[model samples]
Target chain A: MTGGARRADPKPMDVDALIDDPGTKIVVCCGAGGVGKTTTAAALALRAAERGRRTVVITVDPARRLAQSMGLEELDNTPRPVPLPRPVTAGGGSRDGQAARVSGDGQDGQDGQGSLHAMMLDMKRTFDEVVREHADPERARQILANPFYQTLSTSFSGTQEYMAMEKLGQLRQSGEWDLIVVDTPPSRSALDFLDAPKRLGRFLDGRLIRFLGPAGSGTFRLLGAGMNMVGSVVGKIVGTRFLNDLRSFVAAFDTVFGGFQERAERTYRLLRAPGTAFVVVAVPDSDAMREASFFVKRLAEDAMPLAGLVVNRTHPLPTGPGADLSAEWASTAADTLADTHPLAVAALRSHAERVRRRERELWLLERMTSTHPDTRVTEVAARPEDVHDLVGLREIGSALAGDER
Target chain B: MTGKGGTGKTTAATALALALATGGGRVLLMEVEGRQGVASLLGSAPLPYEERVMLSAPGGGSVSVLAADAEAALLEYLEMFYGMRRAGQALTKLGAVDFATTIAPGLRDVLLTGKATEAVRRREGGRRSPGGPHQYDAVVMDAPPTGRIGRFLNVNSEVAGLARMGPIHEHAERAMSVIRSDQARVHFVTLLEEMPAQETRDGIAEVEALGLRPGAVLVNMVGPRLLEGVELTAAAIGELDEVALIDGLRVVGATDPTGLAADLAGEVRSYALRHLLELRVRGELEDVGRPLVELPRLEGGMDRAALTGLARRLSEQGVRK
Candidate 1:
């Protein structure tokens, strides 16, 4: 896997087994944007609960209907219970097996039923909460009122990812859920999710921040004596008024709260823990697969537990009666019969297109698998409609679990 | 152009550039995300920090692409505005440059938008004279996704409360004037799906709230309607004249038409369902009250030829420079 040794066939990712194992405490689905990471997280959490685990899903930005499906109307940074779709049949075949397997876990008194909760990350509220929790009311109010703090809390690039990390740590510490499915923010690059916390941490603990801290602070007193040139230069560049505001913001923030880097480090270690698994979600496109490969390599380099890759929205291989017909033959036949039988021509044309698309998709998948042959892989067929409800999520879950195509 | 992540914003921006480059229009295609998506799509080497001619369009016009880096842009901004290249280098050594450009909440966006708007306002013959001809006929930016576009473009408001009078604030003001003017139009590219369409609508509203003009809604990757109206209805019901299809397949000299007919019918059913959903989304997009330009889903995938085809389609749809 390190040197790109190709595997004849990539191992299949067993999502069910990973979720069913109580040892897997955290499952983080991360990948490029619009690759169905959020839906995958929701579906994984739902499936984990259905299979008898106390599960909670933290989605960064879900579609309205998806949020509604999880019984979350607003992003209040609080988890709400999602009523599990009733079992298909009481004490049915698989239900009995599920209950028997999950009977030993008495964390919740629902007997055979597992519980699920979901929450969307409100980054601003989460950041504000951190301030209020760390500082006294007056200082908290002042910090919240600071224009720089408002900008950082509301529109900062890394705030969402940082807050997501904060919320995940909070959830994990609360011991409310046995399995936490975390959906990374839809950053421009998937690496943003992994890099943001560290970036924010670095910024927080950086020399510039220390230099800009209140004059009485340790670093400021130690270095400010010799850094007047730097301060004046920065002041000239950004204006004295703005610099003062930033200094005060930093001062207040420092006096009340510290060690953002420590929290980020703790979460990084938690992510590296064996109990955590990273599922890189992608689609069968060149850009997304390429991003997925980057993520896979990064996860490996970081010593994180790489569960597998979930290739969503993939076109399944062409199968059934016309399976043997090559695309060229179908296309040529369709072209020849174009004037006479429009219906048959349409059918043939579609079959040719489907065959060709599946071929290309498989080629893309092969490129990914060849790069990381040891990584487990799963493919979910592209759904015609967006997943809008619990049932849609369940269908996706089954597809993810390899229960169906 | 901004859209939901992974909705082919770069592709659409490239196609738009190619389309604008026709008829001797000099087009500058800019990608701010640092993905080099334009370079990859054009099959060119990685784009350098400086602008370079990436493609020559059909009508003797060309597209010069710049993969804008915020750090480089900040250095350029300092040198151009304050003649502080030495000071900039010093700040870089002290890590304050990185702090200001990268970690400073709104300053990075200020630099990015400043660079882009400067390009827009740049005059020919390396002069800033108002009467001089413009450098490029048009400029297209592959901006951040919809979630961040408003903040990325509304730099003045972002810094209005922070830096009230410094060069940063002045540059933000200049950039915002250019961004909010009639010359700048924030087009949205989206897929004909629920999430992307919804996001496009919300993005349009958000930009409007910031007083930026909303441009056309470029719908990317719209699938074709393969089945006829009646056939689609029947397919949706899972009863798509299968016997007739089998007969037709037999007439087309198929050795085994039964399985082929059934498989094709299944495909038609799925297609019909998807097409209906697309129609619903299109209807929703129409309610946003912006011009809609639909680009077809290329059969294989996006390549140079497919991109050219898309450019031709955009031209045919009357998308002008």
Candidate 2:
């Protein structure tokens, strides 16, 4: 089959060794939708914490499964501590160690080597929080109060990405954890999170600046008259006070553009810094691989530090001489039943063919990864059950650590 | 509403348009994404916003294409709503208009839907005017993927919350009338796979919650032929004696001499049978209430020829019926 013959026996994974490696700051888990990215992120963080490194996992996925995995029914915009089993004391008695908590609320906790924290981002809430944190409280409140800002924060194309960075920055600057593991949204918008800060910064620094920045008195009067005339015409046509509201919102938020621009730049710089790393996640399917490749190229183009790739739900072929038994049995059955029972033979043949095809696909994936010498290629076996709790995550983490040769 | 990209939304929409148009109805194929994927699939150049390009199909049917360039469409929208001809000029001057229209999420969606509504209302022929084509018999939209489709189609709700009681609100109400009507429909295209199927379910629930009609579900890349009957059972095969089976095989035996030949042939046949069964199980696509149609997997990707073949297959699958 693919990857040469499989190992004689399945190897045990070294979760502790991988988690303790100081260079591994980012753990990106990407795959097609519903492939357990959220579970992977939580497990990675759990593994890190178990190794005595303070860890925080953040997810921007709208699904509540991430929170539920941490035993919380729901999460908010801020980071909360998740309750983990306290380490055993040297005396063989359990000490009342720090509580592990996971929160959706967008606040950072203090740095600790033995603790774990988790959070889910509320995109719009995080964006508003960023604005409120950077601008004068009154100005921020005014902007938040504006209907346009409300819509823009929630529905804007790059806003989720920008907000994700803002949330990451908060965690990074907090120094609350030794390592941060982020579970990005599914492949659909994950890349946007990487590109969002720069795009948003450009938007703020360019057109937004021109539209909302201070204008010369003479220019203001001329523009105001022009705006008024246009508004009157549009009012007649579409019959709305849209122009008037837009004007007021622009005028109110104009003064804060400089602050917004600065924060966006800071967030962008944080993402590009060496302290952070980008992990690309994908499944073995063609669609997922295409997105992963695009993301890898985009990361290179943007000069982002790509750590490696984490291919999830990879099918593990059975190993050794016994691996071909199913095929041999099918062929023998096929010949015996060729005339007496064509359908049974056909069914067996089909099953064997599917397994062989999957092997070929796996081989192609390995070939695709050959060009990236530096990027580590890791695969997680497809689990028989969905991962939903600490035990499941631990199993996933063990599989991810690779076979202990 | 399928989460998978390149599933065949454009092809289905195009086929539906052709079906309507050939049945003696005028059709408008609107594309929200600026990719011009639909036009390209139809072997025509990209169309501009507010302009119509006639597409004569090989089957003696015709369709029209309209591309909603977000920036230009937004400018047209501003002009139509606010008598702001200079607004477009102003946006161009600041170089913000293009970015605003294209990069702004939901803005493009609003403009595209607004334009569709406008097309629905634009009269084909006045009572006294003869010989003019009807305004439009059907509008087929190759919408965004399922992830944001709900928000994309329901732009009116967001806009209405902002622009209450004005002409904008009035227009939004009018657009809602068309969207909420049975005449307007949304179909999802997905592969009969796990993830895409799950997303389709979620997308349908979300779309229905937003008060939009979820029409047919098109399952693409269905498996080919399947082998059926008693031959599928193990007992029938076990009944054969080894010697008898070998002699029977020898009687019809073909020449074969190669290294690893037996294993390789078995592998190839095994693979073929697996796909057949996969295709068969995929045919049970009853997860959604909409009629399920199957599109066979083409050997090549969705190029022009592939798309035409897909359209023809879709017609043969009785999409109109």
Candidate 3:
């Protein structure tokens, strides 16, 4: 009980200042699955666009969920303009309680009228594009048609992460928008987004792949006759057709493997570059906080520029019974009055549950603060209604900017 | 059972296992993610790949838990095959094994399904020891989330990755056979939220498309609607006299009711909104034509007592039957 007591509030993250600044170009929201990473990225993008910056948000969720929320029929691999409530001029305090200062310095190299665009990653389509662009006509067709290639493009574990990076790099190189917001895939570990490219790169060019390719294809066959004999025996078990499909797939893809590796490394560098910001989103619970803490440490270790943390769905205990009248005391008093006031009893019981939940949230918060000390943090209160539109996103953006209401 | 992340897959799977074990039948609770979520939920030590009995039900039945790691499972698979030390070295270096099991979703499902089915069919010696029963009458798997479940269980898709009509292909075919058979069931543990509900719908559709068995949908963490119909309507329409709630609060030890009244009103409003949302989700879930079970939100948090409470609910809800 003593350990869970509230402490002085930690420093709040200045999200408006971060987004409003002319220097910032990219904001990446990364977190564990179901932690509101997609929602956070969308809200941040909407906020940025409304603040008069040409901004584009990309989400890896295939549901076209963001598009539906923004009132658009659908969105694809290409960025489609999301209609804003108002044309954002060089006005101060535009939309909700957003940051008033829209930085006189023009980052978009256009008029101060802000624009927002959104797109959902079509991973296989993106991979197909990469192949079509990198490989020649004949080789690309062969690689794309291979049974193993089709499966790898579709169901391979890291394909989403790899395609996300590819798309991010492509979006940046296009120079269409001043700011880009990326919603990472809902991986169990935030670090998976960072390690995926490398893991896949290694897997693609590993010695095993080389050995697995047809023995007479290239220099990769170091195991010599012994390997072919083993392959033949396994071939008999799995059948020669399966072996031939895998070999042909590998042989055809061997040409474009270098392009994949180079692009992966390029994206890795882009993530760590200056002007790119990583925002870790989490809910104020033990599981969420633990994942957030790991994200903070990982970004630090990898030297990626982290903007701050956005703690979502926080419940501020109902504020009655005087500011000094702690939730604990109110709960105790409610317990004492349970016999006389039955309805009050129910309300108080609910209050007690809220108090207990708040204490646990605070405990997790305190641990996070103690561990990171210097990391900027902001929180969004739990909203009663689900957010699905520009208006709702603005409220969330306001909340992220420390409005709290 | 599995749903979206944070949909309480572990909780539902554990409770289902507990519910089944309540009838003097042995049950196996397994988690393949290695998150130790099952162990933490049961208030027990972290589970290794090896099986161990975690707790016993009031009905004199026991539930054992296992947390299987991919590396260990792959090694076990390899041991059954060549049993070559050099082969293990070469495979581990290239991570070809992990690739086939983890990175490659197709083969990963094959391995996971194979191991789980094995547990389901294992026969234990008649003699009982301190570790509890070696055999289980039933096995419950905490499966991958909806996003991956389709690929993870889609054996037909992965079978095309290699040559067909061989023993390896037959092995995968056998796993798929079990999945599609009446013996195996895939249930969904979801919340009333739109995302979860929609995902559940899509997942069930996918399962049906692949001709796999889709079981009941358990809606976990359904918050209670405290106020009655008229009270809720009054609250929603802002006709509920705040002064009345204030008076009710004042009758208690609380002298101040302004903040409390506002909070109370807000809670009522949210409750009304949530009630409607649940109705919509309920219709969608029912449309799936499978059994639907609604588990009340546990105010006491996910502790051992709460686990037992949910298990009891499962039993009453006819999930174990």
Best-fitting candidate, measured by TM-score?
1
Off by over 4 Å in 3: A1-5, A62-65, A71-75, A89-109, A216-221, A229-239, A320-346, B42-46, B82-86, B125-134, B161-163
lDDT of 2 at B319: 62
lDDT tens digits, residue span A1-405, model 2:
223453322223344555687655555454445445677678778778766667778886634444565645454775656655443222311212223323212232233344566778788888777677667988888889887777778777777767777777887877655678888764344566666666666765665344443445344456676654543544443335544555566666666665555777787777667656666766665545656676777777878877666777664434432244354554565667677744445544543544554565565465546545455656776553346556677677666666343
* Pairs of colliding residues, candidate 1: none
Candidate 1 yields a Cα-based lDDT of 0.84
**RMSD per prediction, one decimal?**
4.2, 7.1, 4.7
Number of backbone collisions per candidate? 0, 34, 3
Better of 2 and 3 by lDDT: 3
**lDDT per residue as tens, model 3, A1-405:** 312325667788888898998788889998778778888898999888887788888888734445675544543587765656554444633433123233222343277667777788888899899899978999999999998788778777788888899999888888877889999987656778888877777777766566677666554455566565445544654577866887888888887666556768889999988889999999876667777898899998988888998888776654544323455665776677756654454455555555655666777788998998888888787775567777888888888887653
Mark the 10 consecutive residues where model 3 chain A has the least summed lDDT. Answer: A97-106
TM-score of each: 0.94, 0.74, 0.90
| Reference-based lDDT, each prediction | 0.84, 0.61, 0.74
Rank by DockQ, highest first.
Answer: 1, 3, 2
Regions more than 4 Å wrong, model 1: A1-7, A87-112, A216-226
- CAPRI quality band, candidate 2: incorrect
A262 in model 1: Cα distance from truth in Å?
A: 1.7
In model 2, state the lDDT of residue B301. 36
